[model samples]
Target: AMFESNMLETKQREIVINDIDPDALEKLILYAYEGRLEIHQDNVTNVLRAAHLFNISEIVDSCCKYIEKQ
Candidate 1:
C-alpha cells in the first residue's frame, strides 16, 4: 500500500496493489506505517521475503518468530 498523493481521494489513500499480491508487498508498508500484521501459517514466507528485501528490522524479527513456531 503506497501513501503517495492521489487525485481520486481528498487525501492519500491506502491503495491495494493488484499486480503484486498483498502478501508479497503488504508487510513492508504495513509494518512501516501501521506497525502490525497477523503473520501466521498461511503467508509467513511471503511476508518474510518482502521484509528481507525491504530491510525492515521489526518485520524481519516478526517473520523470524513466525518461522520458529513451526
Candidate 2:
C-alpha cells in the first residue's frame, strides 16, 4: 500500500530502492517521466516486477497487456 500524505512529514526525505534490478529501475524511472513504457519480450518480467514494487499502476497495466499479447 502507499504511504499517507502526512507520512512524509515525519519520515526521511529520501527513498531507497533495493533488490530490484538496475536495468529494471532505469527503465521504470524513464517510464515515470515519459508516461509510457517500452515493454518487450526480454525485459517484460523484470519491468513488471519493478512496476509492482514501485506502485506504478500504469506500467503494471501496460506490462500485463503486453504479456497478454504473447
- lDDT scores in order: 0.69, 0.83
Across 1-70, the per-residue lDDT of candidate 1 in tens digits comes to 3234545443635634444456658656666677667688888888777777667677778889878878
- lDDT string for model 2 (1-70, tens) is 2355666544767666688888888898787787667779999999999989878888889999999999
On TM-score, the candidate that comes out on top is 2
User: What are the TM-scores, per candidate, against the unseen true structure?
Assistant: 0.60, 0.72
lDDT of residue 42 for candidate 2: 91
At residue 54, give the lDDT of candidate 1: 60
- lDDT for position 28 in model 2: 87
- All candidates: CA RMSD (Å): 5.3, 3.2
- In model 1, pairs of residues that clash are none
| lDDT assessment of candidate 2 | 0.83
Off by over 4 Å in 2: 1-16
In model 2, state the lDDT of residue 44: 92
